[model samples]
Target: MSTTGAAPGLSKAFYAIIAGVGGGTGRAVALRFARTYPVALLARGEASYADVVAEITRNGGEAVGVRADVSDEKSLAAALEVVKGKFQGKGLAVGVFNVSSPVSIKPFLETKLKDLDQSLAANARGLYNFAHATLPSLVESVSANPPYPPTLLVTGATAALRGSAGFGVFAAGKFAVRALSQSLAREFGPQGVHVAHVVVDGVIEGPRTKGYIVEGVEDGKLNPAAIAESYWHLHTQHRSAFTHELDLRPYAEKF
Candidate 1:
């Protein structure tokens, strides 16, 4: 364990930071990262991450929860500063942007400007701010030769690829996010940052989706823990063969 930024005693242990944490995927990712490094979980409300943080800390892992709105740059910046202060000299080993844009499931003709604006803010603008804030540290981390590549993982959905009916606003935002991820991968990969976009194409198995019935398959939803394992794999991948984009879904999921 490291004494926070202010102290002369630096632990030499880097930290993993995650944005848009919640009870499902966010909690799983935080726990996965906590196994190796101090973890910072960021969400809009303490309720979203407090329990996860406590569980990590209780298990002898260093964890911190910060209330942050990814869509708001100032708030996101403040939360990141907290992360830096907590892990001070240790470089950032990984940064994950798991924010899902609010979906407007309405016909294109019925979609409003505000819905599109909200989606763009949460998906595109939020990622823009997050990358700007984290990349410098990630690049600097390259010199330290951390255990794995300094990675930035973005969470995407099927909307990132096809603009299906009734999902125009969501698709637009996800497409923009995918564009950002592709561009960032090119710009930063040579600089030692592993930027990858993960498209989760099916419904996730979580408390929120207990009632959602999937046709023929039993327990066919994607497990958040399994998704976390994939992310860890991405972080550990060799620089020689970096993955720019990856997609995951249940075995029963349709293309």
Candidate 2:
């Protein structure tokens, strides 16, 4: 998205910029990419970034931790710079994971406009800025690798589409995120950039999800790692059959 700084091995391997890297989904995605490509992990907290980088590095994956708050445009812009810097600052990179976490766990009626605004900032505005920041890197992609343009994976929830009485605002924000992804898919897909949304049909089970859900992980609950695999599939799938949206839930999850 911003000026790519020079870094070795950074530009050659696939470049993945993951926002909210401190969260469960960011961690999973970072680990998934670290296996084969260099990854930049973005989050508001520096400690989480350190932990994620250490985890990935310990596991033998290349990763760098960046401190950035998606809610702030300037912060997000810097994170994109980190991506380019990894490649020795010359070439473009592929992939962006815009996984935002809900700021609070409140019922629909009890939810405040401020909370909804926060979600929009993190989920929608954040996506916009990140996409904008990475556009240059995506556009300058090398033909040899034929990298995907800003392949963005937006995390969505069942309530985003189904809608619950107390989830109107959250659902509204997610709905907007879904729409943005679709718009980008149509506008950017033909250009070699892929945009997608994942409707996590049921609850996501992890430490980040513990206090946010009514029930904890069940026997048949979806695994975060497996969900990461889905992203991998979408990332590598031939541009022809690119799935713009996917629904993933456990077998026990109701349609």
Candidate 3:
């Protein structure tokens, strides 16, 4: 990996990893964190993270894109092994779980079990696998005394807090992820790993959301870059001031 323009004072011996590197928040977060640490981008396909990797490299930051399905234990484990090889002796400074399952919006009667299963696999099981793969390295980094606290950030959604009529399955999965994140925070915070969950409660501004209209509210969609910045804040926070959860939404968004 090329470590051309790494942020000043940030240790090159520690790296960040972001899962679910697509064209949205995942890409933005990966780019933002790459400024501080060589990043490992994980996704189910190369097409999802290839452009982001190139963009990072072009900006003189080091990045590697590894195709792995977080919902699959073996796939994620193998991906981590690849990351280990790439970074050599580095430890994990930050880990972001940005994977979200496809939205299944239908009435409860129409929702199939498969939909619930898929969501569970992607949101809950994926995070489980990702945490298992990265937390050990994050813990080990504590002794290395990096510039900032080692962190694990999980991206959640409005569904994580409440279940809408058409969002039961998705909510179930998100809720499970939130619960797990909370548990992890309690268990790992004392170990020097900052585990936090972000509740993204509005439509995010991105290519996939360009056609989405929020009536007369200008700049109604949440900015992925802003979200990434918030994540960086979370990672940099002192252990004594650790934030276990954060909720982000557009100004006009209702609670």
Candidate 4:
């Protein structure tokens, strides 16, 4: 993504919503978007989003952190209500589904059925609820003529494309997210919404990945800030040239 200035005269009434927010990629994304629009960060608990929210606010950006569990429809709906209350008459400029379920890597024979169920419930079903909750607002934003297209972005992983050994459950869920994102893109692009799936193929450089070591390669991990920049670029792309899918990885990483 180029070093573009802050979005051109965006509708101040519009806000960006990010689900599955935490200290890593989620915090980076929230801060990036808050530069141009009020941002709402959602997580299952306050601890996941409080610091990020405070940081955004301290930087003179509008931010609200809401507790929400996307896996539960009721919880998601209530969170949307909070968003509505915050934005009032405004529409949704961007919606990011970054929810990642806990994945337990184990041999197929050792993996419990519940592991697969947990992955599916959080990744697939959570995104389903998020899409339903945000799409209407995104479609409404189109007519409002915001500075950029209303975008729905899903954060994917290498598992989204390949089910590697010991990662069956994770792959199943990520693959489902990719599929749904594509379907939404096709269905909503003509309606002026940009639905894109982003594959974060390598270990992200953050606290969570601190122990992930690649000998002799200091830059082998993807930076969350850089990923957020890419996401911003996707949101700002013109409708005439929308990207439905994108992948991010470290240059040192092999395919």
Candidate 5:
């Protein structure tokens, strides 16, 4: 949280990239990491990241926003090329996957195959494309001898742990994301890259959830800034003690 400058001992040639920049956690995370490294914000549209990029620049930090759809391999690859050009010799120090698919809450019988496909494309296939594109750079970064390990932090949801009655479609994709995260952690840990999955278990305080009521509980919704701080912590962890998974929720929320 210190605003002094980038983290101590960090190389100027290392940078961070966050996929899915928006008004909520994505924007918050981008700002948090920007404190320590030049950052690249990726989203499907410029509107999703424009303001966040401006904010970082305003604060004397380096940042760039790119429009890229993680679910589409070609789109994501092209975006990385832009990032490479912008950062030039910088190595990827951190990669955050915060993309989510639109949810269709309905009974299983009423659910359409298209809905399932959409979720899978954004959650599972999206991560697939993202990891393939970033992991090689992450692996290569190990030789850079960064102060912390190269890291990949994934954003998951409550649906990843349980398939609620109306959340079958969402759960199916989140579950795949979790499984993939675990596999990547195991495979990449020995190679000196940190891969972790984070389960965000409560409604986040954001533009979209402003009208939702959590009766009798003041500040019941999760704070996106707080979540971003946790991500910063994860990225700075020592490689000797890597955390493969972390779950976060508000204090008043039920388990």
Candidate 6:
């Protein structure tokens, strides 16, 4: 997947919703977006997320923190309401960034049925509730008098499409999200709503990945800014040339 483009003026994007704000990459992405957009940081860890919200507001941006466990459908619905209330009538929400990961790394043989259910609840079912509930706002934003495009970005991992061992359950849930992106793209692309899946193909720059240049790893590989740029590109692609899948990694990262 190639990275490129900016066919129009930048929208204020008054409302930028980012889930999973406590983790490494999610925080970075949220901060970057908040630099120019009103951001809503959602995570189960409110105590930690509060600091992030303050920093954004202090930097002359608007932000609010909401708590929700992606594993709980009801919790996500309520969280979405909080987001909607925060951005109510702000010309609709310009984006929904699904940064939450539902599964952890575990060998297939050792993975339990319960583990699979847990992963699916957040990765697929949670996403369903997230998008289905937010679509009206997205459509409203795009059809506003002046017009705007709303981006639904699902940040997926390389394992999502590769389906390697030790990642059976995780991969299954990720794959479901991949399917969700493609279907939504087809269903909503023409309506000025862009849905895209981003595959971070290298080790994300995080605590566990620090100082980690392994044979199969790219040190400082998938920086949050790089992934965020892909979101920008996906959102700004021309109507005739929309990119549905974007693969991102450092220049030296291997497949």
TM-score of each: 0.94, 0.85, 0.96, 0.96, 0.96, 0.87
True lDDT of residue 253, candidate 3: 83
lDDT of 2 by residue, 111-149 (tens): 777887877887778777777776656655634354333
- Cα lDDT tens digits, model 4, 1-255, are 212346754347789999989967898999899998999999999999999999988998898999999999999999889889988998789999999997678888998899999999999999999999899999998888787889999999999999999999989999999999999999999998999999998888878778687545988888899999999999988788888899999988888
Could you tell me how far off, in angstroms, the CA of residue 31 lies in candidate 6 after the best superposition?
1.9
- Per-structure clash totals for the candidates: 0, 11, 0, 0, 0, 0
Among all windows of 10 consecutive residues in model 4, the one with the lowest summed lDDT is: 1-10
RMSD of each: 4.8, 5.2, 3.3, 2.2, 2.6, 3.6
Give me the runs in candidate 1 sitting further than 4 Å from their true place: 1-12
Q: What would the per-residue lDDT of candidate 1 be over residues 1-255, giving only the tens digit for each residue?
A: 211122132225678899988877888999888888888899999999999999998888888999998889899999988888888888998999999776669988888899999999999998999999999999998888677788999999999999999999999999999999999999999998999999999989888888776657777888999999998888888888899999999988889
lDDT of 5 by residue, 1-255 (tens): 122224764347789999999988999999998887899999999999999999999997899999999999999999999999999999899999999998779999998999999999999999999999999999999898765789999999999999999999999999999999999999999998999999999989899998776645868888999999999888888888788899999988899
**Global lDDT of each model?**
0.88, 0.69, 0.91, 0.90, 0.91, 0.72
Q: Estimate candidate 3's RMSD in Å.
A: 3.3
Q: Candidate 5 regions off by >4 Å? A: 1-6, 9-11
For residues 135-195, write the lDDT of model 6, one tens digit per residue.
6777767766322357777788887788987888888888898898889888988887778
Residue-level lDDT of model 3, residues 1-255, one tens digit each, is 221233474458889999999987999999999988999999999999999999999998999999999999999999999999999998889999999999889999998899999999999999999999889889999888777888999999999999999999999999999999999999999998899999999989888888786646868889899999999888888888899999999888878
Q: Which ten-residue region of model 3 has the weakest summed lDDT?
A: 1-10
Candidate 1 positional error at 164, Å = 0.5
RMSD of 4: 2.2
Candidate 5 local Cα displacement, residue 15, angstroms: 0.6
**TM-score attained by model 2:** 0.85
Better of 1 and 2 by lDDT: 1
